[model samples]
Target: MSYSTLPRIPSGWSQSDSQASTSPVSPEEGVVQSVIKIPSTTYLGVESTVAPTPQFERNTADLTSNERAALLASSSSAVAGSAADAPDQWAWRDVGCEARTLGRLSAPITLAASLQILNILVPGMVLGRLGTDAIAASALAMSVASFSAAAPLIGLLSALDTLCSQAATGSSRPGLPGIYLQRCLLLCIASFIPSVILWWNIHPIFIYLRQDPVIAAMAAHYLRYVTFSLFFTLAFESIKKFFIAQGFHHAISLVQVLGTPITLASVYFLAVHPATSIGYVGIPASVAISYALSSLMAFAWLKTYGGSRGWTGLSWEAFRGWGRMARLAVPGAVMVSSEIVALDLLTVATSYLGPTALAAQAIVSMTIQSSGTLLMGLSAVTANRVGNLLGLAQPHRARNAATAALGCGTIVGIVLGVILYSLRGQWSYIFNPDPEVHAIVKRMIPLLASLLALTVITALSLGILRGQGRPKIGAYMNLASFYLVAAPVGFLTLRYTSMGIVGLWLSFFMAVLTSGLGQLVFLLRTNWYDQVLKCEARLAHDGHHEGLMTPENHPSA
Candidate 1:
């Protein structure tokens, strides 16, 4: 069992000679021992003496139990270590990791979205109780304010989504998110000037665009109150992104949850109270107050909680990154605005069809928007994960994250499509009691299903692109799909065919499909190693000196 007890070699051969014979030798005879020679007869009738090289011994009986155990354990550990260190290949192997990561990121985001939707819907609900005319005015005001003010501002501020997420993962500075927040706040304040002018002149603009004079005037009145909340709303949005990038998504959800009741109560008191002369303006004013409160609460949490580690306080450092931020913000705003414009145009097209068709469109639009909240949550998760991976210089994992996001989005889309398809007959009734509108919705079920699926995929793709710091690509795609393709198709179909709402839905579906497919192709063809280098360069430029940390140097690597 032990080496000392092994049988001794023959008298003429030493231990070294035996060991040499057991080991492999070259073709030359220098390393061979003469004692191991063998006589051989050649095939050509020539007799010769040749030495046969001995095969290495497979038997391990010469070694002790302890030595054998040690060798086996070391070999096993080496194999496991290599496997652990190996880069992920393009495959569906890591579904569990992907699913878990997506779930962790999605839950809070979805909850926050639900609360946000409640904030908007509560005001509308409260205003509906005032009177038919009041409800109509409120609706007009919401539409105009959303398209003219909310959409552009939200779009512009979206730049922080990329910057903060990337900065959190990529920047060496602890206060990057705070700096981003400060920069965005400055931008929002500057934007407020033009927004004020637009809100002030909305009545004339709406009239010139052939809106009902009474509704236009009422909407202008509504915006005047809501305009005060603009900066606060933008501030809330910026801070929300700041929290999200720092992996503090739960805090945002909590803030929104806490703010919802305040919003509802404010709206009720202002709109329904007899002594209050706020009237329809109270709805927007309540919204503004709710937003401002949410921002303050989130800010308080950031300061009191450990989130303030990133807060260096107001400094000139906040102004240093305006150019980089603008480069992204402007294109992001355009990208978001293009999509909004397309939807608005679709709404316009629906209007010409009749009130019934327009009503049906509204129901479908609300349903689609609600369903899209889930995708939006997933998209935020995707961006954050991808940005984090890229920041760590793990391109393979980043690729894996992106592909996994697409897969998860696809699975979610399919499930959603199936559920929506099954409920298509009765779903519209939740939004509209009318049988005719339900019928139109029932008829458009297939288009709705397709649109939902496409929307999920496109949203995930856009998120990945944003995380990669390539929002311009998304902007260009939006421009091409919405303007060059969907718009023209929508116009031609509506003008020449009796397809009505179906035609408009089809056009939007095509646009989404085009964008999604284009992004997928780009993702597949991307040289991720190059992206890793670019990510490193970005981080370096932003004052992060931890340039290109390899697997050996990275803590997680």
Candidate 2:
């Protein structure tokens, strides 16, 4: 509320005038005025000899006392010294490269990350030994299981990711821990609906597929086990997202590393042990056990790290606080679910082509799906960063973060595509040993390789849109691409043209490409930055500062 004037100095200042002046300005002397806010103070400096820039003066008027002090500390003569001496403090620069820089980093991160998840597919190697039909059945089971578990959970986790990231960025909001716990409950409850549907409808679905009774029976068994595992699956996912939003990627990765060996061991024991009646049941059983173990690990990590701090108490009121959370989450859920649903529909289409085609489709899709973890991981990080920036009332930074994520995804996608293409021959063996399936897969590899590259681009762009909180836009884009463009295009080519299964794969590529392109266009056309800024402004007006970044006056265009 107060203002100040500078001491007497020449209107048109020169260094030599200062040298002859009775009170010479020392090079190392301080000239900034410190502004005080409750419990925090900030300083701003003015040049005694020159008119201040409009932006600089505006920043002075806009920032609180603490923000001003922080800015002054950044620009002062001893700024570096002060920074080095102070405890690690939050700064815009410390948020790192929001857009371009992050995108560059995400490329290698995506490729290497794909390998880490691909390691999870070694279990399929054991299953592939059970003949082409068995391998086909196994692949179908995994697809169904992953979709059922991931669809409901991804949305809840995405919301958690947004909330936790905002809190970490200094929202000064109480009840973060409470909000996290309640969401965990909501996710668990929501997951049960899908679990029940998969379990109850498995028999009817297999009938629709005209599966041989034996194959149908085996798939149903697998579904039952997978259904049981959904609870743990949801739990593990929620905890992982919670940590990831807090920038704790290593913990989740570590748990996956530890759980992998247990998974392999369980799969081996189930396949070989005569005493065990489950036979192939070991696959889903191993999955179930692994989820339990991983969830427990995540819970322990959360308690040790987050529980010790302010995130201890549980409160249901956190759930009641925001209709916005639910609104954001619903479309997010739909966008992620659409991807899974599209794959399931593809499975249904492939079923009509016989077991060989189904096995081939399963392997290719599963391999592509495994690469999805990398996309999801990078996307999750991007969304969290974007949401946090918006929370802090920094729309430009939020947009930059989203852009960076897409760039990272592009590099990752291309590299992964090349790797998949190069290993096309070897990858067939990972699915099954049947000569027909292997031969068909090898023939299809080239087309699939091309698809992978394009798919990566599409997937990454989807990540960018989701991160921007336009999940509904992404959902619509997917619907248009998959149903209107990709599916119809592929079906016609496969039935009428000689492309066959290969045509189907090509369609998959086209659908994703259309969806990605559309989403990217939306990002460009819509003033998402302004949307984010406006949301921040509305929240401030409503006195909804809880779980948000430090408040700032909304900027006028």
Candidate 3:
């Protein structure tokens, strides 16, 4: 509820007048954030020698990935402090190295993220056996659940993305990461109340929205039964962040690798089998159980072998930072949930086209969900890699890395597009045996493929902004693209025209295009040399000399 007047730098970023006289960060001043999220990236960028800018003093916990990266990058010039350590000056090989580094870090993060998504996808696949209505109904249930559950979780926990990693730098306050972990876990629980209430009685809302009463009722039933997984999944993610914050980035990947088979098998026994199956209800029940088991195993690790970096057990003090966290968390959520809501509304809108079209939307959405999560993981790595490059004051390399990240993300997107296209014939069958869903999915493949590529490019574009410590720009772009552009396009295209489900995706395409091109042009015009100075200014103002930079803490990847 409190606000203050902060000075503005000539570059338009807020700064403090006092930092105008602060000294530049020396090479040995502080440690850089090592490791990647869930997997660490190799340091390979260089520094700039411009005069330092004045950075504002603020709460480190409230900063996003780019600012945190700037602060850390300014604190240490270790990666490219010498020409010997510098990446081969200005070669295409530089681009290749950046791509490879991004790829290596991206694999584990993508795999683990995909494994978690299987909890949603596998259920849809199993329930698809129950016919098209099941897919349509489950889609509705999940659309609401995602808004209520997944979106909110993403927002509140996004603070931890910056918070825990910043806390772990140099192990200065190991216990702070633990406190953050506890705070995030507690916050997720406290915030789920509204979502749970809505899920418990969402049928009326759906009915009022003109959703088929039968699908609404089925969706409502599935949500009511599957609600148990919400707490466990949130806990699993929080604990995963805890491990990542302390440098055990591989822990969650191990859990996911072990959990995937259990998830697949659970769906078979609890929902798919003729004798053991408990019909539609069993599909979601199995998902809940898989999530529960994953959470339990993650917690067990924390109890037995985890917490070595900074944990000293839970503290009551964590309860106090909700307001501070909320200030950061809510905006992060709004940025993320806007996209989620837009995407879900597309699905919800498709419901009016009947079970056949709704079923197709389900397949398309889930397919994209799993694939898109992978690209999203890649985007996280892009942000961190750029941040690290900036930390070394490597404007040239940071720019190159940013370019390389776009190239890498595009290639991955194209490949996923190919995969989505190639499997267009068979992909729908993975979720449903119906030929009708298959036909609709096939028609949508071309648009879906293009959307995939655009999505990655756009995501990587924003990742550069994040690395540059300017997430608000990306947030604003997202808000405008999704709300002002996509919303009207989608509504009119769907309601006024006969494009059917493809119109929904068309709107998504326009949104990503608008946001992506906007960010791309901005990054191209940016002054990288000044960005390094800004990084130094950020750390100077944050006032940390020996931060807790650890191997485990990075961004959300």
Candidate 4:
């Protein structure tokens, strides 16, 4: 088992004891590589060699043409063994493979992000045209929607980032991805119940919180019109994850691109046309219609052009995996909700400062969100890459993927920070024309830039955690950093100090920094081998009894 003597497993291929000494082959050889197995342990520091299962070898040739192409692309480098044995021997050292994987995942997501930003911006712009009352109402409505409905739903749906990516690489079953999508749909629909109730009663809730009665009533009306689109939005999210997990990233971009103009047109028409009864509520209604159309298009694409290999059609099997899905979904929901709630709390605190302060905060917040889209795309890349490696039972490669993602995040953060810093004084002009708001935004730019860098790190870490099936860890970190650390500092600074809005943003900066550091530590300390085992256990518990390379199935056993 010396490092030099160890066989070179092709990039996407795995090897067992018998194959450990096999020489690397060219892609032309068409060798059907088996899944690699970690050496079994009989006692502390004692290893047992296991032969490859004949069944696995026999089934290798059954891989689909696309699967074969994927393997070939990845096989350009030798697979690295466990990090415990040789930490520096990871396969991601192949700069080509790393770049190809990262680039492939990042490109489409970045494009899709433009559409997402447009989705946010168009509504705000349309409302701004109607008057300050409309602008205030739309802002409040969006905040409430994010906190009460969208964040939780997005969090819950995030579980698919783990389930679908792992299943894509780990399971031999073709129907697993579709089944997971079904489960996600069911979970989202169930969660939508509470969201509906919250949106329906949001007016009273906002009033009770002492928000402006006029804005509260207007926002409530907006939510009422938009509530019908919740299920469609969640469905689109689920389908998007399905595509991303399977390396169909461009399809998502296409869907978003096609939907964006429709979104813009619908919003413009509804908001400007006097004949429309919707009025201010038309902004959300247009958003709803856009989501529905986008989701339908995505579904149609999935069924037709996109590989429907994993989709076995509707089944009762979707209803069967609730327990396991919840293990990831619940924590994911909390992690997402915590962050959104923290931002909303900051919004509330700023409101107390006056309309000018609130307007300034919105411009800054929107800018940060827009600039962070590239990093969010990178986060999705990290989740898929890490999950795929773990699924292949390659802990060292998974670790490398996580490291690469963090490095990428840092580099991207620095670039974005520089851009934000350079544009600090002028960026807010795109959102608001008020000179007072611009002044406050100028004062906040330094803090906002710093927060942007920190957020990029935190977001990527959370993605890594999700990929590793450790959403609960992210949840705990968010709770501590945001609620325990950031919120208190923000409240004290806002109330007891002269820092004003700058103080609130500084607290946010501190919270994001804390979260990023916490996640980085957790990632460094992770037992990736244990994670491999956990993935196996999850696959087994889900009754996917095929394609697993467990210790019990080792030849030594």
TM-score, every prediction: 0.77, 0.76, 0.78, 0.84
Superposition TM-score, candidate 3 onto the true structure: 0.78
Off by over 4 Å in 2: 1-119, 143-149, 177-181, 184-188, 273-277, 307-310, 318-323, 526-529, 534-548, 551-557
lDDT of 1 by residue, 65-121 (tens): 322211111111111211112333334555445555566567777777767676655
Steric clash pairs (candidate 1)? none
lDDT for model 4, please. Answer: 0.71
Best prediction by TM-score: 4
**Which prediction has more favorable TM-score, 1 or 2?**
1
- The CA lDDT of each predicted structure is 0.65, 0.58, 0.65, 0.71
Which model is ahead, 1 or 3, in terms of TM-score? Answer: 3
Deviating ranges (above 4 Å) for candidate 3: 1-79, 82-95, 114-120, 302-307, 383-403, 462-470, 522-557
| Residue 389, candidate 3: C-alpha displacement in angstroms | 6.6
lDDT by residue (166-241, candidate 4, tens digit) is 7776665667878989998898888788878888877778889888888778878878876876667777778877
**Arranged by TM-score, best first:** 4, 3, 1, 2
For candidate 4, what is the TM-score? Answer: 0.84
Segments in model 4 whose C-alpha atoms lie over 4 Å from true places: 1-85, 273-277, 547-557
Clashes of each: 0, 8, 16, 2
lDDT of 3 by residue, 1-557 (tens): 11111111134432233124233333343422221111122221333222112231123223323223333333222323221223344566656765665555556767787776776677777778787777788888878888777776765665555455434442234476677778777787788888888888888898889888888888899898768766666676666655544444456677877777878888888788888987787876776777678778876776676534457777896787677556546655665676777889888788888888988899888877776666555665566556555554445657777877888777778887887788777777888887887888989998998888788788778667756666566677788999999999999998899998988889988998898887787887786645655554443322243321322232221
Candidate 4: lDDT of 405? 73
